[model samples]
Target: MRIAILGAGSIAYGNAALLASLGHEPVLWSPSGRSAGSLANGEPLVAQGAIEGRFRMDVARSIAEAVGSAEVVLFALPANGHRMAMDAAAPHFKPGQVAIISSHTSFSGLYLARAIAERGLDIPVVVWGTTVTAGRRAGDAAVNVSTVRAKVDMATIPVSAAARGLKICQVLFGERFVERADALAISLSNLNPQNHLGIALCNFTRMEHGETWGQNENNTDSVGRLLEALDAERIAIAEAAGYTVRTIREHYHLSFHVEPGPVGEMARELAARGNGGNGPTSTDTRYVLEDAPFGLYPTVLLGRLTGREAKLHQAGIDIFSALYGRDFAGENDLLGPLGFADMTLAQLKALVRDGWPVEKAA
Candidate 1:
C-alpha cells in the first residue's frame, strides 16, 4: 500500500524507512516544510539499531500532494500536531483512506474524527497506543532505533472500523497490534505521560541544569514508588471506566525490554544495563511541555468524570503549570473545543464508542 507519512521528525523518518524496507511506497510531508524539504532536496533517511537501512522517500510540499494518492496517512508527530495535521489533510482524504496516529495520546482520534465529520468524509481513524519502534535522531533525516516492540496496543474510532484498521496496520507494519474496544481505552494505554510526569517532577532540577544523568538510574526507590502511585491512579481511572489498560510494569517490559518488577528497580536495572534509560537533556523537552498538557491534563479530566482522583497526575499538572507560569490545560486544542462542561460522562463515553457527534460544533 502507498503510505503518506505526515511529519518530519525522528518517528516519521524511522517509520518511513521501516515501511520502505517492507516494500511499501512511503511518502513524507511536513507542515513546516523544513524537514520534508531537507529530505526532498536529498537528505537520505538512514536507519540503524533494530532495522538497518538507508532509504529515500518522496516528499510532498503540501497536504494535498501528500494525501492525493495515498491509501494510508500516518501522523507520526506529537499530540500537539494532531489537530493542525488533521485539518490540513482532511480535505484531501479519500473515501476509503485509513488514518493512523502512531502512539496516539490525548484523544487524537476524536479530534481527527471531528475534522473528518466536518468535512463529511468517510475515513477510518486508527489509534495506536505506541509506535512500532523506539529511537533517537542521528541527524535531520536519520534515526537510530534500539527497540522494535513485539506488539503495541491499538484501537479504531466508531468501533466499527476495528477489524479493517487492524488488518491494514498488521499488513503494513507487522502483525503486532493488540486491538482495544475504543479510543478511550487506547488513550489510557499510553504510559508516556504518566511516566514522564514522575520523571519530570522528581528530576526537574536535573533537566534545568542540563545534567547528563541517566533517566532510569535516577529513578531511585522513592521515585519508583511515586511512579507506581501515579500509575495506580491512571489504572484506577481505566478500571472505573471499565477498560483494562496496561500497567507501567507491563509498559516497561513491552516497550523498553525491562522485566516486570517495582517501577524504580526495573528502571534502575534498565539504566545499569544500558538497555533503555535515555531521555530529555533539558527543561525545554517534551517531558513537561507536551506530556503535561496533552497527556496528563486529559487524564485528570477523565479521572474526575469517573470519580477517581488521579491526585499525582493532577498535582503534576498543577506544579508544572506553576513552574512554567502557564495554564497548561488551556493549551490543549481538544479539551476546550470538546466542551466537556456541556456533556455528561455518558455522552463522552458514547462519543468515544461512536465517532464525534456530527451536530456538535467544532
Candidate 2:
C-alpha cells in the first residue's frame, strides 16, 4: 500500500516508519519542512518506546509528490488543524483515492466531505477517532510508541462509504478498523478531549511552569474524579445527540493493555504504561490545545443543542481558553461554526432519529 502522511510529528514519523518497515511505500510531509528534509536525507529520527521494532522513515518533498500515485492519503495532523489541512489538500484530492484521517476527531470526515463537495470533488474518507495506536513524539523527529490500539472505532461521514473506507484503512493498518454509526460517535469517542481537558486544566501550572509530570503517575483520585466528570459531559453530549458512545474505561481496555477498570483506574494504568520514568508526561502536551477545539468544544455544543447540561465540559473549555487567552469556541466547531447554530433542540433530536443516511440533507 502506498501511503502519504501529512505532518512530521512523532505520530507521523512513527506511523511512517511502520509503513516503511512493512515494505509499504510511505511519504511524509509537513509545513515546517524540517522533518521533510530529514526524511528526504534518509535519516528520519525515531524515538523508541514500549512497542518494539520502531524506526522513522524519511519525509516527502511535496504533497503531490508524497502521495505519488498512492491510493491512501493518510493525514496525521491534529483535529484542530484538520480544516486548514483539508483546505490545502482539497486541490490535491483525485477521484478513486482514499483520504483517511489516521484518527478522525469531531466530524473530520464530514469536514473533509464538505470541503471536497465545495470543490466539486468526491472520494472515500475513513474517520477514526484515536489513531490505530497510541504514540507520542518524544523529541524532534522521535516518537514513543505506547501500543497499537486494539480497535479503531470509525464511521464514514455519509455512513454510505463504510465498506470502502474500512477496506482502505484495513489495508493501511492491517485490520484495526471498527466502524461506528455516524460521525457523531467518532466525535464523542475521541478520548483526548476529556483526558486532556481534565489533566491540563488541573495541572496547568506544571504545563505552564514547564515542570515535567507523568500522566498516569501524577493523576490521582482527584484527577480521576475530574476526568470522570469530564467524561460524563462527553457521555451526556453523546446521549443528547442520540448516539451511544462507549465510556472512557471501555476505550482504554479495548485500545490498550490495561484490563477492564474504572475510567480513572484505566487512566492511571495508562499513565504508568507510558514512558516518563513512571507515567505519561503532561508538560507541553497536545492534550488540551489540540483536543479542546475539535474534541471538547464539540462535545459541549452537542450537550447545548440537545438540552443536556455539560457543566464540566463547558468549564474545561473556559478554563483552557482563558489559560491560552483564546476563544476555544471558535468557528472550527461542528454544532457552532457549521451553521448548526440554527438547529433547535427538537430539530437536533430529529436529526439524530434520522441517522445513517442523514435525513436533514436528505
Candidate 3:
C-alpha cells in the first residue's frame, strides 16, 4: 500500500519506518518543512528498539505531492495539527483513498468530514483511540520505538466504512484493531487526556523545573486515584451517551503491557520495564497544551451534551487556562465554529452520522 504520513515528527518517523519495514511505500511531509529537509535526502530512517530497521522512505516536497498518489493518508501528528492536516489534504483526497488519524481527539473526523463535504468530496476516515506504536526521537534521522501495541481500538465515521477501513489498516500494520460502533466511542475511548491530566497535575514541578523524569514511574498512588476519578467521569459521560469507553486500567493493561495492579502501580511497573521513556520535561508540552483543549475540553463538552457533571474535566480546563493565561476552552478549532449553543446532542450525533451541512457563502 502507498501511505502518506502528514507529519515528520518522532511518531511520524517511527510509523514511516514501520510501514517501510512492512514493504509499503511510505512518503512523509512536514508542515514546517523542517524534517522534510533531512528526510528528502533519502537516507533511510533508522529505527531501533521494538521495531528496528534502516528503512528508506520518500519525502513529499509539498502537501500536493504527499497525497497525490497515496492510497492512505495517515495524520501522525499531534491533536492540534489535525485541523491543518485535514485542511491541507482536503483538496487532494480521492474517492477511494482512506485517511486515518493515528488517534482521534475530540471531533477531528467530524471536522475533516465537514471540510471534505464542503468541497463535495466523500472520504472514509478511520479514527483510532490511540497510536499503534509508542516511541521517542533518538535523533534527527532516527527514532526509538518502545513497543508496538498488541491491539488498538478504532471506529469509522458515517459508521458504514468501518469494515473497509479496518481491513486497510490491518493489512498495512499487521496489528489487531477492534472496531467500535461510531466515532463517538472511539473519541471517548482515548485515555490520553485523563491520563495526562493526572501526570501534569502530580508532576507539575518536574515539568516546570525542566527536570528529567520517567513518565510511568511518576504515576504515584495519589495521581492514580485522581486519574481513576477522572476516568470515572469520562466513563459516566460515555455510558450516558450510550457509548462504551474502556477504563484507564484496561487501557494500561492492553496498551502498555502492564500486569494486574493499580493504575499508578502499573505505570511504575511499565516504567521499570524500560519501554516507557521519559515523560514531558516541560509544562508547555502537549499534556497541557494539546490534551487540555482538544482532549479534556471536548470531554467536558460531551458531559454537558449528556447532562452529566464532569467536574474534574471542567476544572482541569479552567486550571490550565488560568495557569497558561490562555483561554484553553476556545482552542478547539473543530468545535469552536460549530455554534454549540444552537445544537442538541441528538443533532450533533446526526451531524456526525450524516455530516454537517457545507457552509454557505455569506
Q: Work out the TM-score per prediction.
A: 0.95, 0.87, 0.95
How do the residues 102-139 of candidate 1 rate in per-residue lDDT, one tens digit apiece?
87877878878888878777678899888887777777
Residues 1-362 of candidate 3 have per-residue lDDT tens digits of 89999988877887888888888999999888877565578777889998988987789888999998899999999888988888888899877888888889978888787777777666778888898888888776889998888879988776777788899999999867988888888878998898888889788889999999988788888899999999999999999998877888988888777776778888878877875888888887888889998999988888888999899989999988888899987888878756655678888777656555445411
- What Cα-based lDDT does every candidate model obtain? 0.84, 0.68, 0.84
Question: Which regions of candidate 3 fall more than 4 Å away from where they truly are?
Answer: 356-362
Better of 1 and 2 by TM-score: 1
Steric overlap count per candidate: 0, 6, 0
Error of 1 at 106 (Å): 2.1
Question: Which ranges in model 1 have alpha carbons more than 4 Å from their true place?
Answer: 357-362
State the lDDT of candidate 2 residue by residue for 1-362, as single tens digits: 77878877766766776676666877778856665565466655564664555454646667766665576888887766677777677778777787878677666676576666665555667777787645666656566776666688877655666788787777766877777876667777887778877767777777676777776676677887887777887787778667787887787677775787666677667666553233224444567767777777767667777788778878877887777788877835444444566767565443322322322332
**Candidate 3 residue pairs that clash:** none
